[model samples]
Target: MAYESSVPYRAGTEGYTSFRIPAVVRARSGHLLAFAEGRVSSAADSGTIDLVLKRSADAGRTWGPLQVVARNGTGTAGNPAPVVLDSGRVLLLQVRNAADATEDRIRRGHVPPADGRRIWLQHSDDDGASWSPPREITGQAKLPHWRWYATGPGHALQLRHGPYAGRLLVPANHSTPPTDPQDSGAEPRYNGGHALLSDDDGATWRIGYTDSDSDTDTGRSVAPNETTAAELPDGSVYLNARNEAAAAWQRVDAVSTDGGEHLVRPFRPQAGLSGPAVQGSALHLGDRGALLFSGPAHPSARALMTLRTSRDGGLTWRTAHTVGGLPAAYSDLVRLDRDTVGLLYETGDFSAYSTITFRRIPVEEPT
Candidate 1:
């Protein structure tokens, strides 16, 4: 059977010219919330982008209008990482930047601290109805000397097993200088992956131990940026990352047992899973005895929005079905119920930047 998708957001609609970087979460009360960055003018990726959202109460069969959740005026505000707590509260963690600012300048120490891609958070007590003002959490969520950083860009996780039950975990990536400098720009040489947690159900957050190796690996996509995570039945975090872009367009996976505080090993490339240096998503549909991953299954291109399954807790993976054969990139997955999941991803005809889309896939056993 062919997988069907809905174009809830178009490239030029709702006053925004482009929509990108999708993230979705199924709230505790059964409301479905889909999020993306609404680029105001051109799709340059770093200017006048606001975090926007759409709500669906009918399990994605229908959706409401768009609502600007986090807007920093003309500045850039994006990377929607949302997670729903057991008590029905929705916590969103995002990144902020200055208007027209770029990542190169920030990494070279050419940007000011005020708009240097820091962390901010917003929450809603009544499902997706309302959101609080964007509160800066840079001090708590970020560490000293870190330059480029990003959260899940997908649904964060809440531990349901082990001693850290109810712990809210956000899989994230960051970068700093290597042990030795080779450039005059003082550029960041290594990328690191870690998890941020909130013990009080999203009230406050703290950075974890910063993965393995204080001075870890690096790549174009980097070793750990734009990664997704799932909690294994043993209470360990199974992390899947976009390993390297320009060179090896493949994916990597690792495990962390300390409630996402650290990884057991550096993320090693998985042989079967293929990508085009794009972000993907992972959902541990543990009850159904399946581990699901979403991304462009094409070996060297960002087309074919495909979903793969790993029945043996991510030790292996196989393509089950594909969403489409269009230009697709950067996706996030949400668990709708025991037998279904949702995908919010960037896809279009001209390019992947046309608009962020949503797809509903019925959970099935691994092929």
Candidate 2:
């Protein structure tokens, strides 16, 4: 199936040296909002970064001018996790850190609390036209022992069916302190997947389903990072995360039966799903009774953007459609309507960070 694509955010174009971490959502106003990290200096993870966005009023055909949703001056503000509430208000969760505070320093607990990674919340009442000032929610969303933290870097989920319906859930990841005092906490093994929940709309937040086991030697332990989630057909929540373990596959997964409060199944390598160690997105097709995943299909490198489908609630997956064969990285999925889906991703000829494109694909083409 052919796809209609457009470059919403191109590196070096919007006063940003690079644009990374693509996230998109359809607001209650029926407008598509595409977001990314506007890196001011370089494509590196650290430095002055702004949470930027663009809106497409006519599906994914075209995008509006760039808008800075949140900025921290010389500090870093990125990892956008956006969701539209039932009230038509759009809530966005993101993180911030000092300009010089790199992930290594933050993970190793070398930075002070003020300069360390912190979570923040922002809301848009006029769709993508304007946004409220960022309000810190780090204490409620982050654990004291967690050093490195990040929100979805993609679109978050909201429950539609069951008693927990209307609850806002955000898939997230964090790094715990090292078990061994002599060991540095910079190891990816210390990373784990988690979720943040808000019951009273986006007014308050709390941590949920933390997979921070201190023992890395245990075969059951998994280093799940950069997570994405979807609500299954049976009202359960399925989480698919980027596995950081060197010996395991690039993907790990779990399930939460009690809304987003706890995980019934802990993080484990998802068999048959092959890809590089990078972030991916998951979506549940309620009408079709199937689940969809989008990410790179290459086993060793971030390339070949592919879409997979699982009919049995994420137990297994099969290649459904290959979107493109280019250098691809992080991606997010949005349901445009009953027949079409939208994908916001990073892809380029030479590097994935060169452009963040939005692609419209037929829903039936992937199922």
Residue 355 displacement in candidate 2 (angstroms): 0.6
Per-model CA lDDT versus the true structure: 0.82, 0.89
Report how far residue 194 has shifted in candidate 1, in Å: 1.4
Candidate 2: which stretches are off by over 4 Å?
Answer: 184-188, 365-367
Candidate 1, 103-128: lDDT as tens digits: 77776767777878889999999888
Q: Pick out the ten consecutive residues of candidate 1 with the lowest summed lDDT.
A: 212-221
lDDT of 1: 0.82
- Overall local distance difference test of candidate 2: 0.89
> Compared to the true structure, candidate 1 yields what TM-score?
0.94
**Residue 204 lDDT (model 1):** 87
